[model samples]
Target: MQALKHFRIDFVITAAVLVVAFLYDSWAGVGLTAILIVVEIVFSFDNAAVNAKYLDRLNHFWQTMFLTVGVIVAVFGMRLVFPFVIVCLSGSISPWSALNLALEKGDPHTPGTYGYILTEAHPAIAAFGGMFLLLLFLDFMFDEDREISWLTWIEKPLKKLGKLDVLSVIIAGIFLLVASETLVHETHVHTAVQMRSIVLFSGLLGIILYLAVSGLSTMMEEREAAKDHEFEEADAHSSTGQKVLLAGKAAFSMFIFLEVLDATFSFDGVIGAFAITPDPIIIMLGLGVGAMYVRSMTIFLVRNGTLAEYRFLENGAHWAIGALAVMLVISIRYDLGEFVIGGVGIAFILAAWASSILANKRDAVAEGATDSTEQGANV
Candidate 1:
């Protein structure tokens, strides 16, 4: 019952959307809307865990922004305007024309339809999102400061390799070149030369964007750490204004990072939604509701300290992210269904949860045995 309180708003929004959907297309509309909501939630479950990890570091004001302003951006900006922008760019049309085409809800199989244009744009989308997410995963895997190891065999070697500076960037560059040369040939939307150019340019942009945002975040974090150290050394607290300024800077960078991460996660969900239904409104209602729930879940996890409770949960989410990054790149050439993508992440989360339980039990038993031996010695 206590847990349900966090999701109360999500439920209300879901009901409202369902009512609108039913009014629009009767029972059929209601059914499709339900399916989409589930799809979005299942696909983004690990995303909430990942978001919570960063969200935990933010101040209260920024955390509220994530739920309020962030929700508006995710629901409308990404779900509606972002797709229109993509169509306009890919189809060489105006925003109005893109909206008109979307309203027409033409068959995706038909070449000139909005859906067709979006589908054709998949290669570049995959390249950009794949590279961004790949770097994220690589950085996590290679972090020398990471104290915990979920997969010892894999993470141990990667942590050792982290001593070599910029290794992740070099590896990502190799992947981009390989993907450009090999995967570009699989697409029929553009000529090999054009496809190669698009993939290389988009992938590079993704890499550059990741580096820029992450660099800013690291700088802000270091500054904040320095300020804390200074205050501690002086045995004094900083003024409220100075603290707020530093917190604001750190929060702003993290907010940008979170939004970009959301966009990368959304690429597949938005594209995959068309496979289920062509109606833009329906897709928005379904995904919008799901996005709200994901945000709520992040807050719940942060407030409840779920990540701290389940020690391996964050590790599992990152592992799942690494898998998704690989899949996004492979999806440039092959159409792996949404189920395959979402299922892989869910599997990792479940496995990690179970492992955490076992670890707790083992530790408890070990402590019990030690206590018994100590008591006997004392006696």
Candidate 2:
């Protein structure tokens, strides 16, 4: 009963979203959104599990931010807008027309449109993916305690700044400004510019809201902790309220961060899909739906302790992230099919899961043998 109550909001919201989607079902709009949701869900299975570890730590306010603000940005920013950004950067087609062509013809770079003007796999896109991959590779190699020579001068200072809530806001705002300006500049058509601005602004808004909520949640947790001076335990403290708030913030932060990751992952899929079909609406529907399902699956994985039970899963996901990052960089220079990236990621995760299951069985068998030996000796 208690668990059901706790999940009531999520259930209701999901239902509501589905209902709206159903009611609005045009062959192009709502119907497409539904299918896309499934696709996003499948692609994001590992992502949700990774996010769950963090979600379980956030507070109520932060949790709300995850569902509301986080979803808005992720669904729009990456799933809907990213394809057009690719088109703009390619320089042959207007963003709006590119999107339209994608929807109508089911291809972003069809034979007739300006999409024909430039080659597939623009250089800039690859650079973006490469930069992201480089970060992941370095993070994996160095671990948290490792230091980078290039960042030595600023690393400590940045670490300190990260601890400051206010600084996060400033940093997010700056990033938003840059992304927005870049999107606007890349877009050739007036309508495309407007649409790009809206999408970019929404993303910026999400980042700002996330930082603000996280800061407030942190403050509340600190205040509550101070109130319970003697409260200490190895597993959990007596500050239930504080824990909830903290958990919510952590969950929200994780959700937002994961959404960013999903966006990064989707770059190749969304852009490459344009080659098959140009309609922005269809592309958006397919990708958006897929993204949502992945988010849900991630939450389910976290709640179920899937990753903890299968340590190899984390390694698989991180590896996928690294690979996708590299793929993005390659996308900038040459054409690699979206199917290849998605397929590689799925295969890696499946293999990791299998390995973990086998390892668990082996460990269980060993433990049983030890227990039997101990019992025989005692008898």
Candidate 3:
């Protein structure tokens, strides 16, 4: 009963999604929706941990905002509207036209079919999302203070290279250019030159989006730090109002981060859904349900402090993200199936879990040895 209260909205949303799933009145439709949802939520286990890092830092009011308001954004903004926007920009259609095109869907090869349009726009989608995710992985790799190394041989060298300024951007650009060229040669597109232009511009937009969001957060953190310094000298403790105010600021920034991160994670799910079915409503319902559960999982991890207990869990998620990034770029030319994508993500996460267990056991053993050594010396 108590647990139900926490997941009440998620329950409602899930019911709504299943109803939407069944709206088409076809077994194939319903099944595809279910499959996409499972794919999204399973592959996004890492996303939950990532969101918890930021979501847990905020106050109850802000957390509630994420639970409520964030869902609307995830469902409507990313799942429904975002794809439309993608097709609109790439296909050169108005919003109304895009909606009509999506609704009046035909065969996959048929012009203006939702699947066709979305598939056509894959290069741009892949470029934008790949750049965003690549930056994310690069930043994590370059993080000097990161202690754990899932791939130490590669990570150690990257960490060293991370010392160079804007190296991530440079590497991402090279990949983007290479990927766009690959798409020109490999993918069935309208034109090589046009695809290159769209991809290059979209990839740049993605890089800008990531830098802008992260820069804003860094700026806010700096201001918050300065405020804390003043508080330290001015008073023994801050007032409730001041604390709430700080929390609000932090939450606002985190809210932005959460939304963008959610979008980045959804990139693969969005494209991968088309492989199952291209009906926008079906994709939205299925992926939206998955998004709801992912958000719920994020909140669960935050409240349960799951990341604290499983230290390397977050590292595994990020590594999975890096792999996903690579897959997105590679998929531009190659038809890397959803099975491959989801399988790789799960493998990284499980490997991380196993590594965490070993680390904890080793830590316990070391602590025991140290305690015995001290006791023997005392005796």
| Predictions: Cα RMSD each | 2.9, 9.4, 3.2
Candidate with the greatest TM-score versus the true structure: 1
> 1 or 3: which has the higher lDDT?
1
Q: Highest lDDT: which candidate?
A: 1
Off by over 4 Å in 1: 186-189, 233-246
Tens digits of per-residue lDDT, candidate 2, 228-256, equal 45554433654443343354333444555
How do the candidates rank by TM-score, highest first?
1, 3, 2
Q: Estimate each model's TM-score.
A: 0.95, 0.62, 0.89
Which of the two candidates, 1 or 3, achieves a greater TM-score against the reference? 1
Candidate 1 positional error at 262, Å: 1.1
| Cα lDDT tens digits for candidate 1, 26-95 | 9899999999999999889899999998999888888889999999999998888787888999999998
lDDT of each: 0.88, 0.54, 0.80
Decide which is better by TM-score, 1 or 2. Answer: 1
Worst 10 residues of 2 by lDDT: 146-155
For model 3, name the residue pairs that clash. none
lDDT of 3 by residue, 1-379 (tens): 7557767887887766677667774677678778878878887887887788777777777787887899889989999988888888767878888888888755657766767878887877777888898898889889877787777888888888878869988999898888777665434546677767888898999999999998888788677767668665676455434442336465588688878988888887887787777678788888888898888888888777777777878888888888888888787767798889878888888898888889899999999999999999999
